[model samples]
Target: MRLIQQLIHQAVPDLNGRTFERRSARGIIVDGTKILLIYTERYNDYSFPGGGVAENEDLIVGLHRELAEETGASRTKVLQEFGYIDEYRPHHKPEYDLIHMESYFYVCEVDCDFENVQPEDYEIANGSYPVWIDIAEAIQHNRKVMANQEPSMGFSIARETIVLELVERELLGKASAV
Candidate 1:
């Protein structure tokens, strides 16, 4: 996959520090101008429907698993690789000083009908739920959250917002032009 962007958080001092590397797969499922996203009530922002890929999991497999688990999405077909975001930030776990996260995004198609969603405990606590929202609306909502710097805001907000903008410009833009 191509590299979309590389972000270094304010908390990350240097690249030479000890870090825990994590790889994630994010799905960009678009239907017209609407995009499937996870809205976290606690954070008041929207993000893609995907998560961390297990160490032994293939990226595509991870993407499917995450989509099913988070959004109850079925019959998902990856249309193409969108891109990825490389991010370095402070590790929440005490075992590592920093975290290097590579979030791979794929453009996908999924069945309209959804089943039971099984978001992780933390996600549930954060009031995370799936929804198909207008892409522009999601982007605006995230920008508002970031601008306010709300106490409940999560670290992924910036990354999610940037990717949403890219999707709007690259995917939606092309589609509209056609």
Candidate 2:
């Protein structure tokens, strides 16, 4: 295994004994009435602002780093962990025959200045375009644009899980109703 892979496996051994590998983390950054999303060509969906956890990096720290790297917003704060989603991709990485990844999701908060946030060039090339959408609209867009067969497949559940919970908790207020 590569050095980073070894370190990551060690860090998230919960994935041990599984058929596939890799663990990642993401955040649902809600700034007022707008939730931060990333447009990705790979997934062909609008999704949250987070990414994989680097070797030996703390999950929360990775969330912050990915948020900033992808969304250009460094001051965001994690409010609570929402849940985890599992995805199986046959050709995600050519090196591996298959990729089974578990992505941890968190609900986060950022100031209202996210409207002008910019995605990094590398991220953009990787198909990430930062956009803010109302929570309900985001959920609909995610369902419509995602590549999942089942409503719960891939990162689909994690996509709307946090938002639904937050809405139930009244964090999203009236915007939660769309």
Candidate 3:
């Protein structure tokens, strides 16, 4: 997969340790002028509808699982992939030091017969919920997030912001190249 983007921690210095690798699958669901997104007030940001791939789990299967768990989109179809994003950051904990996350992104469509979201404990606690926002609104929200003092899950926020811009340019018929 191509590296669509990379997000690195700004204030945190890069550690001189071996980078731990984590792989995940994400979905991009767009409908007309709005797009499906997962919002986390704890982080004050939005992300694509997807999650981490479990041990020995196939990427495709993991994607379906994540979509169901995160958005409850049962009647869904996976379209073409946009690409992958690489995010490198210092581990939230001290011992791990450097951590690199490779997230695979795909274009997906969902039908009307979708189920309720089954969010994780952290998500429920942190108010992670779904929303369909106008593309313009999403772009503006992303910009606001970028200008904030400190973003929770800064890597995810920064990368999502970039992806939203790219999506807007392509789908909205914007001439600006990503």
Clashes (backbone N, CA, C under 3 Å), per candidate, total: 0, 0, 0
lDDT of 3 by residue, 75-174 (tens): 6688887888888887776667778888898888875223578888988898888888886777677667777655364457778877878877866665
- What local lDDT score does residue 70 receive in model 2, on the 0 to 100 scale? 70
lDDT of 1: 0.90
Which residue pairs collide in model 1, if any?
none
**On residues 75-134, what C-alpha lDDT tens digit does candidate 1 reach at each position?**
789999999999999988888899899999999998735557888999989899999999
Best by lDDT: 1
lDDT of 2 by residue, 1-178 (tens): 1111111221233433334566677777666766677766655556667777866888888887777767777487878777675555443445655556667777787553445555667765766677777667766655554435543344434434444445435655553333
**lDDT of each candidate versus the true structure:** 0.90, 0.60, 0.78
Instruction: Quantify how close model 3 is to the true structure by its C-alpha RMSD in Å.
Output: 2.5
Query: What ranking of all candidate models by TM-score puts the best one first?
Result: 1, 3, 2
So what's the TM-score on candidate 1?
0.94
Query: Candidate 3 regions off by >4 Å?
Result: 112-115, 150-153, 175-178
| Preferred candidate (lDDT higher): 1 or 3 | 1
Displacement of the residue 105 alpha carbon in candidate 1, Å: 0.3
Clashes (candidate 2): 0
